[model samples]
Target: MQKRLANFDLDLALNVTESTLGILGGSGAGKSMLLRCLAGMESPSKGQIVLNGRVLFDAKSGINVPSRDRRIGFLVQNYALFPHMTVAKNIAFGLPKALSARQVRQRVEAQLAAVQLQGYGDRYPIQLSGGQQQRVALARALASEPELLLLDEPFSALDTHLRSQMEQEMVTRLRTFNGVSLFVTHNLEEAYRVCQDLLVLEQGHAVAYGAKYDIFERPGLLGVAQLTGCKNISAAAEIAAQTVLAGDWGLPLQVVDSIPDRLAYVGIRAHQIRFTEHANQCNTVPCWLVSTSETPHRMTVFLKFNTQPDHPQDYHVQAEVFKEKWEMLKQKPLPWFVQLDPLRLMLLEA
Candidate 1:
């Protein structure tokens, strides 16, 4: 819908169609409201919802189709299966009565097999595991053969191991279906795994949206950096052309680009923060060892800084480190250096 949510401080000038459009957000980010609007359960104060070049909700045209006639598949969080019905019957429940009993049975069989539960059709909801029940839910939603499938946290009910398994399963099954899928998930790793593109929402607003790499590599705000787990983040002050970032790590960073003299938020990824004992000079700030941890893949050392060191004034620092170089730091407990990687650190514009 073009500008659907004008009320409640929501001003989404969004575009959509039968394509799978994920209304992703934390709870109360207007995701359900958008879903409701699309399904015609609720109407927008202003805007037009277009589907396949057809207007479903047009305030100007005074057209608001009812939910059932909208032809959409919405699989909600609860999996909403009827306790009494068998999995097969649940899947075929939405099918037209005019279909021959044999046809319905055939479709149900195919759906159960497609969801990798070919023989589970005879079982009731209580008999299936949480993951199995969700598979049936997905099959039921897909059975209707809608233009789009909206899955709201489809894997939430499953445990970590099962969730990962179901993630792969969803990808395989969704590929067979021609329509787009709007799958909601809070797992950052899962989000990175499933989506080629991304839309990050914060406090009822789309704070960032782009390719996954861009959002991770170049975060837009402090919130986004934190959301994506870009570990080192702190406040900095700009001194004319050079921006000075200083924080717990005692490192002072100079802004590579010219920003007006003011305070700004500084962020750098853990992997990007380099620890080099290259020099006892301005850009290299000293950090005292707190403790260190070593794992098979990489080493993580904790350090603290006493005061803000002198700098051309660029960035703030305090983060975990990886690679073999980190191995050397774990042996000692004293002063060290954190050489901020000039290229990778970010200065959020205030």
Candidate 2:
């Protein structure tokens, strides 16, 4: 069974158990919706969500179990701490009271220690900094000892340096949980750095879901291509039928790949465009220098083109090179031959 999301269009129906799948997408891509659906925070209009051999939600089968029994620990965005409660109380909230006072105190103490907040137990949420408070949230979630963990934008609140630090800590701690961990984040770099597998979403659909390397190198679909930052995309026929790229540059490119005559998008990374010494013999073209910005370690050169037969806005190609390249050809505006690898030019279906 399946139903449409409020704003995004997706047909999310799958059984996730024991595998930690990282969902990376921009906001409102239904990543959190699916998680909430699974957790029973938001009921699905249709479809079924199963976790660890338990039937959580089923439309036609009519078997539904609420979130509590599903054994899912969710760390939502914004930490969601109890402002008035002490840190220890927040973590202890998840444990059963049937345990003696000694046992409860022992568990909370252990959790606080794990999150590096050993003695911050008596302090309320306001007394703790944002990072420390988030630690409390994470500690509380893990305190439940759930079989599945769902973290949504878990590190967005922290500063860059703190975020990196927490990620290392979380990965090491989560390793021993022995349960499925589904995490969602809009940060591509975070997804790359933290997740073992990636599920790239676009407009509420699973455009690409697989190993992280494959999605970055080849998105396997048009939506995924756009999301993965393929700037120089063009139809496949434009390559075979024509000898150049878009816009007016008319920069002649040799057709190396026997591409099928179909609507497709071809892309090359900005850094991939660079200069070569052999201007006469290389696959170079007559290009004029638009502008240059020199940084301590590198230089970015913008090339103004007369024509790029099929590109948008008469755009200038942005290329980055080492400071040495600028020094080697100092004080001279020169036309360099461009040698673009055919294999580097990815062709994805439009």
Candidate 3:
């Protein structure tokens, strides 16, 4: 499908079966636009959308299904719920009008129970907590038994604790859902934990798409490496069949596989940098600490090789170590030996 927005143009073709595909990207990368097109909120400039052998949209044939008739359930970023209606009414709002009142009531009750909000149907959305409000929104989306589910940053508005809790609930719910689900999020960890497959977007174009692990372990593009949380990347030029000069780091790296002909950059995850006692180790570099920063359970140690002059902004690599390891390493002297494992190195293109 292709969509041309004010400053962005999205051009990509995707095929999804009975699986949850996570859309990952930075701001303005068109993650939400893709969801909007699929949900019939926005029309694509061209191409066809066929779901379950039914044509949802076809530009060539001049066919476009209205949003209400698409059988798609969308959970927006804010969990858009009716302020005046009770939870039960919100869930029943999307039910088919042809159904009897008794049927509607039964479906509403079933959905309430499904989302674990059984007896709270009488309460308004404003009366519920953020997590509870999200549950109410989810119940409303599922009440009509949609064939396709699209979630646009559903957990973005929650607190850290609440986001974690809702993510677990969402994982459980998606497991039993019998339709294709498309989840949009800028959080890498959230995407990795919830979805089996991943589609990475950059500037409204798809840079990578495959199983989550495959994309994480071998992100083939510079933008993809950054999006996947690779902290260390350097301009590279092939020096030999299995070696490349990491220009920004002032180091030549040995890779496990033959260097790709189109290599533009090389990367390694922060946690993959190994500390070794011996300077004789292959791909080992003797380095001095530049500085350090800490999270709750992890510490980021910035370092530069002895080959480079001391400068505050010239720290070449940052290694993330567990707090326990950081405590031990801090007791050691200068000139720490770190190894860049060839197997863990990522060769990337522009």
Candidate 4:
């Protein structure tokens, strides 16, 4: 399907089956837009949307199902709950009007139990905490017994501790759900923890899509590498079958994987850089410390290779080390050797 906005145009086709697919991307990357289109909240400019063999949308045939009839549960960002309505009422609002009042009450109670917000249903949304409000919204979404669920940054408004707690709860909820789910978020760790598969979007385009491990381990494109938390990417050219020259770092790396013919970038995670005492280690680079940054439990050491001169951007690599290791390594002398493990190297296209 395709969606054309003023500055961004989303053009992509995807098929999802039974598993939860995480939509991962930065802000304005069309992550939310994709969920909106799938939920029938927005019409696609082209192509067709078929869910459970039902044609929800077909641009060529001029068929567009209304959002109400799509049977999609949408837990939007900020938990779009009715402020004046009680939790039970908010959940019951989504139930079919054909059902009797007693049936609506029963369904609402069941949804409340599913989200672990049973007795709290009598309270208004304003009286609940962020996490509780989120639970209420989830209950409302599932009240209609949707065939698909779309979650858009559902934990964006919660505190760190609460977010983590709710994430575990959400995992349990999704496990019991008998339908496919689409989770949209910019946070990589959250996506990794909650979804089995991933679809990475960049500038409204799907740069990569696959199993979570495969996407993280072998992100094939530069945009996907960045999204997967590859920090030390450099312009590269294939020098040999298994080697590539990392241009920005002025280092040639021997990678475990074959160098792609159209190689445009090489990357390694900051934590993958290993500090070693041996000078002759494979892929070792002797470097001088440029700076050290300390986080609560870790340290970021910036180093420049001996071959690189002292320029403003001469720091060739940033290595993340534990605080204990940093304390031990700081005791050593200058010209420390760091090894770039070939096994963890990421080769990418333009």
Per-model CA lDDT versus the true structure? 0.70, 0.72, 0.92, 0.90
Model 4 per-residue lDDT at 33 = 86
Per-prediction TM-score, please? Answer: 0.81, 0.84, 0.98, 0.96
- Residue-by-residue lDDT tens digits, candidate 2, 65-173: 8776777788988988888898999998877657788988998888888899998999999998878888899899888778888999999899978898888888877
Off by over 4 Å in 3: 307-309
Give the poorly placed runs of model 2, Cα more than 4 Å off. Answer: 1-3, 15-19, 96-100, 235-261, 280-286, 291-301, 305-314, 320-332
Local lDDT at 107 for model 2? 87
Consecutive 10-residue window with the lowest summed lDDT within model 1: 308-317
Residue 118's C-alpha lDDT in candidate 4?
73
Stretches of candidate 1 off by over 4 Å are: 1-7, 16-24, 96-98, 240-243, 247-250, 255-263, 277-284, 291-302, 306-318, 321-329
Which scores greater on TM-score, model 2 or model 4? 4
Candidates 2 and 4 compared: the better one by lDDT is 4
What tens digits encode model 3's per-residue C-alpha lDDT throughout 1-350? 99998888899998998889999999899999899999999999999999998899999999999988888999999999999999999998888888899999999999888788879999999999999999988888888899999999999999999999999999999999999999999898999999999999988899999999999999988999999999999999999879999999889989986677799999999999999998887789998888889899999999997654367776999999999999999999988899999999999998
lDDT of each residue in 1-350, candidate 4, tens digit only: 99997778999988998889999888889988898999888898999999999999999999999998889999999998999999999998877889998999899989888888879878999999999999999998999999999999999999999999999999999998989999998888999999999999988899998999999999989989998888889999988778889998889889998777788999998999999988888799898888888899999988898754476556878999999999899999888899999998999999
Candidate 4 vs. true structure, TM-score: 0.96
- Most TM-score-accurate candidate: 3
Cα miss at 28, model 2 (Å)? 2.1
